[model samples]
Target chain A: MSQVSQATVQRVTADLYVEVQQFYARQMPLLEARKLEEFLETLTEDGSIEHRPGGWKLEGRQQLLTEMRARRGDPEQPLVEEISAREARERNVSYYDGLVYRYWFDRMHIEPVDEDTLRVRYQAIVSMTDAAGKVSFEPTTVVDDVLVRIDGELYTRSRIVTHDSPAWADKIHNPS
Target chain B: MSQVSQATVQRVTADLYVEVQQFYARQMPLLEARKLEEFLETLTEDGSIEHRPGGWKLEGRQQLLTEMRARRGDPEQPLVEEISAREARERNVSYYDGLVYRYWFDRMHIEPVDEDTLRVRYQAIVSMTDAAGKVSFEPTTVVDDVLVRIDGELYTRSRIVTHDSPAWADKIHNPS
Candidate 1:
């Protein structure tokens, strides 16, 4: 096995950090607006996205486009993005409430695989609003966006959304 | 067994959320400031923190504290927190990224757990920034915080932070 030196790790880390930051800025808007074509532009045509459930990995741009269209069948909703911490012990765990609101956007999550390729996971919360039309503090809905990166860029490979959480489930306005 | 009503679930969720929020607000400052005595008060006396290394789980709060203290001992290389998320996907299985930012006295991530007991998996790119004279990001020091709810209250029972993803590591760190 080759030894990963401190200098080498440090260099890779810096580049990876830059890549992640750039990815975040690009993906935030399209997710909020539910713009499929615009979102697809971020990916390599031959790239793929994988859904966490059913272990279903969608390959190629065509299947990804199909999934995006299906997602658009439902009306888009508002979501806020933030960062929070969790303390895990043994195996069971719980997350602390309150989060450092980084930059709230219509965005999702992504992970890297190897050097150029990446795995992506996107989510949105579900919540209810009051009669005053103010957004409720509670979460109502959640959407998942997972993708793969090809040639140092990300493309939508797989996606899904669920109503189990109140932020999205109860308030979902199905376009069908 | 009786079905858990949505109202019941909502109430539980809200209460749990509040408790976690309070715990963080109270403890974050002490932990970040490295106020050991004050920080220790937040734990349940016998409380412990864990990190993943190879095929085993590290145990004990004292051990964790000792490790943290030693890491902090590096004066030339001060340790700080920096968590950033990239993407996420959720369904029966959830995936996530780009939902965390940590800075010594402050930390945040979108934590998702199962509805039954509220055991959540931490899926975020957690970066630590080392601040000596000025604040800078630490690329090599990354971590994940796992959590669980107990007795109708939420608390971080465990943490599984490792250099690589866990065995069940999927997508994580989306706000769902």
Candidate 2:
């Protein structure tokens, strides 16, 4: 084991901070635009997203992509890019028609694991806007994510999310 | 800022891991014993404890100590230390009577901030045993804490505790 000098800690923290912030800023727009394919490309093949409060942990890229599509899919319509405008209008009754998702991340601390791997603790909020532009923000989740640089691109290896209030995750599934 | 050598990162991780584990082992016993003064002494003057599932963040040592005493106080009587054995039995109407708290820390990861401070991510479970020896474990909390070494003694600067399940923290406040 080698002792980390003060200089080394500062250097690692600053670099990792930049890497993670840039990744989030870019990927969040793709997520908001519902460009799942492009967003998925940014993730590693073994990446996973976990909602810790709900005990929802899906591992592996293929499993995540499949589950994500289903979760974000509109049951009444075909995929967004594949459907025509008339077909999209037909699905308005489902309330998912022309749906929008907005997500933002606040700066957080970065801790290095290795030259290629680090962990970031960040606070983020996601808002859901219906076809009518009725936007609602769910409770915030402080996301602790393990990020790695592969082929000079940053990817989230694992994400563990925590809610601010107790029972918030339960409320998400079973509305009051 | 200087880049950390692979050896430095490994050394810091190993040393901090051992230091934190030893600290918890000793302090948990003091906590189980309900030795508030000694427990308080182990915390930094500006120590804060945030229970995340509720967004309950209290800062400063005095405020924390006061609230902790109230929350964990023996409702049937004063503190356990000041009460007599017969008096303790007389106030044994609630299960808090003869309540014994046993805590177990499963694992911890150390992330260095500087030579003096670092954050430790730890998973811990606490079980409460009544006078009848019936023990039950509440849901676990993964605690993210900042530890600082002051005067050669490790002190908890801040603790952000997030439970494994959504409703666990609420359960503590309102029992079923």
Candidate 3:
């Protein structure tokens, strides 16, 4: 990691910085909105994510899609009222209410690995706001991402996430 | 507002969108770091902010600087141990610990008010992360900003912020 940091730390151009930021801006919201298919499109066909704390990896778009689909459930199927009520009770919210998660990425440092690929490291803070408007944070994580330029558009090639704390180590579920 | 939205809703070019996002991306970190002088540089000399909930306005760079100075105090003067201890007690943190605020701006909608100026509206969510890593959110806000291009660089000419909820109406202190 140190060698990569020292040897390939190319200065990110102003244009490229903005382009990368915009890419995440568009991509993360799709995940938050549960637009799984759209979110998957932001990654390469062989894109992968490694959860360091969980010691698990999801490789390729098909595997990624399968995991995400299982996590998000079938969007076409409406939640049963009984299950909704049980979830509400478990979450301490009204029957129809749920948590809203907002992901904020900051302190981004970008380094060029090659002409087509860049290494991007950033702090990912996930804030869960409940029906009562209270916000709580998941443990902060530092994500190292490999982004590739494909025909002038940016896509994630791979991601490695390391949590800053182990409090939620057992709860690692999200791909990003 | 509707008239402006309807009449001037020009499609934001990819270049312009990236430019606008980049402008805020650079401008906001200055504020979080309490780099008031540098943050002020991102605004026009005659830039103004109107707090809709508070019904108070700070007009021009001088006034904005004065308010920020009061809020941040003199960085040159070190805080006495007694005062630091008191603040720690008040914030329920260790003697040297403090809260870190992260500002996230999202869901931006940009419209060309004219050739030289654009009206940008976005949701601003401020999260306060404590030393213990607990995060709480301030009431969300919708900020409408008028940005003008000066010598090909973007500068904020004016900002109007409307709180989404009244929870923090009386606690509004920061300029952004």
Candidate 4:
């Protein structure tokens, strides 16, 4: 790679950081809402994700959609079901009734790979919030992404997520 | 307060977001190194921190320096002590030796308080890494900061830290 001026690199990073944050801010909500098609739009058609520690790779947007659908289930379907009286009494209904999952990305570090592409690395922490207002955490992961500029907009070209614990791979790949 | 235009708000937020991130990026390292005086320099002379849930507050640079010194101990003092043979055998030496604390701030939301000030709110997660490479987390907190620009540089004027758990206030107030 040719050496770029330090001044130019700083300028690029500052501008790119804002754009990347905005892109993810818009995109992650779609995923949270299970708007799979809209979330897929944030990535290139040929984009891919590689989950480390398990060596699982989802190639192309179709595979991405498939994996996400499998994990999130069909949003169009009804989520809740009628429960038996005994089951309802046995379990803490409030805790399981309105569970929410949240993903937080932080400590972003950006590097310019070239004029059009950038490498961004960040730590992601996941949490589950129950209706009772209790929160539990999942193992943190480090995500490295390759983002490319397309028509002045940023899109993920590829992503590699490496979990802090190997046990997390089973949970992520299989869900519960 | 006069109503600012939406376009102007967007522009200001974009610019100020970069500035705040850069400011923290520089300031946090000084804090991690226990450079209390330098860290205080990043804040206004009369800056204050309010810890919610317990109503603990530290006002002014002098108080900040005192509180920080009390928590971090004197950095000039040597940290390690020669352990007795029995102590080394009974306790995990690697876990206590060379321990490091890290703070991560993310998901920032910026609101323009005025032409000269911005209210930025973000989540902060604290973690400790032991020499054995084990990592543990402290309670996550939401921090609201009022930042002001003085001659094109940003400085924190006030901060409010609200921990997710009330028990964490004890840890912050009296570190063990």
Candidate 5:
């Protein structure tokens, strides 16, 4: 294994920082547009996901699409995009070029299963705007475990996570 | 559309937690063991990785392998895993079943690009350990734009983010 010089590490780390910022600026809006096919294009062809319990665990683009079919029973309520924040860290770097990283979603925390995988988790307090643009708040949490691979390509094999359940009354009484 | 009950969210989130934890237990060992082929099984067949400048994108499993081959040139330095600390928050909930979440990883963070997608921007401080257990620190940051389709499936479409330049030393040392 090539010893990572202090200079090499700094350069790699800085490059990674800038890469993350660009993703948001260039790709987020398109996702929020619910351009399903377009959004999927952002990932590798074999990309997959697995959350947990009964309704988590999707694999491959085809399977992913099948899962999406189940979630978007109504196209109108398609998953929309909202920008909150993004972060990453190389928790540990071992001798053999292994890098463990963690990623955060609003209230979700994702760690790696290996050098090339992901695991997600979260706990959160949230605020939402209703159709009238009225604001509301709630507290919730989630934990997601995902596996990501970057052999020469980037793709996820597993994505398992947990989330809090919502009540019908909450949605009915306080509709977004 | 099915109204999401608070209970549903909580239950789902919890399951996600357990799944993620399990994944870590299973995956970390495999990686530290350097079971590269086994690790490959955990990724989508057509996965891709966006590593650095000059459009260093790797697509397909074989491509990923090539990339890894180029990096893991050292047999002496084996990979290792470490524990991670993280936090999460729900920023917004849309009437359209959209959720905006913010998750923090050490000093970095990732937020939802939309209900199902994520945007990440981050920098990190890594301590590198050699075969003799010598320790050194390296700072590497990554900005990732990832989108997850949460239809019983979780897959990332794209993760486009900037990273510190490989030639950062020249820039830093020379002050260009």
Candidate 6:
């Protein structure tokens, strides 16, 4: 059974799978930190993202980054502010504070297009930790997108996110 | 290069991919003809489908089929008539004769799960030939779904379709 599974992975473009997995891994921290500008840099110039269940859409990196921050706040009073260092793991056990947001991906499926492009889909979960570290979980979201390689770098060309519940921002930032 | 492509296929469970491709290929004719009952059999006993950009959803084969036909109308006045066949095709060429809706799939991507499951995504287009044989096209729709092998046969577990424009039914039956 293990051998068959390994064979399946070998048959699939495991290299590209690992590359994309790492891309998402790297992305989470940036998104968690509200690094919208950095995240914007990871998108193609003509990229567009549409979020259903919330009806929010952003096209192009410039506007995308601006709106991402605006959705958070006036930069100074952003949504969730936290120091993500090893910060005394002992002291970071509270679940209540300002706001907490974390995103993780699984059930990943990818289709390799040539060697420079990948069309990927995955399920993502959003978890929140308040200023005091009180945590709450949001429902999993279905994410579909295209990743393109340009000039030896990878960037997202398009993304469509569907939430199982309501808007992601509303669930996390404006908790009931 | 051919060897590499073949190797990728070998790794990715090529048999399953072929099965799913055939499934969708077979599905097109059934769907284009509005064979809802036959199409219902292609879904699992507990299947669900949702159409986005319009937020229409259906769960369970019974309700799904019922709502599908209901959305069209009573049996006498179906939204689309059959014409894929030759004589029937010729008889139904009048733009004012009846409503005609057709669906075609292309640019399909598949990922195999074990030996009996596949996650597939594809782009589909809808075209209609009115009673006068005047044909019009609806916007392309992005489709994503999972197919599971049940009792040695394949059945779709879930399907989500996102339309690029308005719904096909609205565009045709209620054309402006």
Question: Which candidate leads the pack in TM-score?
Answer: 3
- Candidate 3, superposed: residue stretches over 4 Å from native: A1-123, A127-135, A139-146, A150-176, B1-7, B73-97, B166-176
lDDT of 4 by residue, A48-163 (tens): 98878865788788988976665554323332343321233344222222334456997677787877798889998776433222355768899999999876567899999998
Clashes of each: 62, 6, 0, 0, 99, 22
Per-residue alpha-carbon lDDT of candidate 2 for residues B84-176, written as tens digits (9 for 90 to 100): 222333453222334555565655667788888887887877655433223345678899989998766678999898978776543532122
Candidate 3 chain B: worst-modelled 10 consecutive residues by lDDT: B77-86
Write the residue-wise lDDT of candidate 2 on A1-176 in tens digits: 11332223334433455566688889778766657778877778788887755456778878876655645544234323433212333443222334566765543546677889877766556565655455654555567888888888898888888654333443332111
Model 4 earns a TM-score of 0.54
For this target, which candidate reaches the highest lDDT against the unseen true structure? Answer: 3
Q: Could you tell me which 10 consecutive residues in candidate 5 chain A have the lowest summed lDDT? A: A87-96
In CAPRI terms, model 2 is classed as: incorrect
Per-prediction TM-score: 0.33, 0.45, 0.56, 0.54, 0.31, 0.43
Give a tens-digit lDDT track for model 1, residues A11-123.
Answer: 44433533443354445435434566766666566656543322346677677787556433322222222221111211222211111111232333444555654444344
Q: For candidate 6, what's the RMSD? A: 17.0
Each prediction's Cα lDDT score? 0.38, 0.59, 0.66, 0.65, 0.36, 0.60
Q: Write the per-residue lDDT of candidate 4 for residues B11-123, one digit (tens) a residue.
A: 54456777777899998888777788999999999999887765578899999887676554432333335432123334433222344667787666666677778787777
Is candidate 1 or 4 superior in DockQ? 4
Give lDDT: candidate 5, residue A4.
43
Please provide, for model 6 over B1-176, each residue's C-alpha lDDT reduced to its tens digit, 9 standing for 90 to 100.
Answer: 68855654566654455445445534544554567787787788779988787466789999888766644332124234432222222343322224445455666777665677777888876544433223345567899988888655668999999888654424433243
- Report the C-alpha lDDT of model 3 over B139-175, residue by residue, as the tens digit: 7889999999976678899999888765444443322
**Docking quality tier of model 5:** incorrect
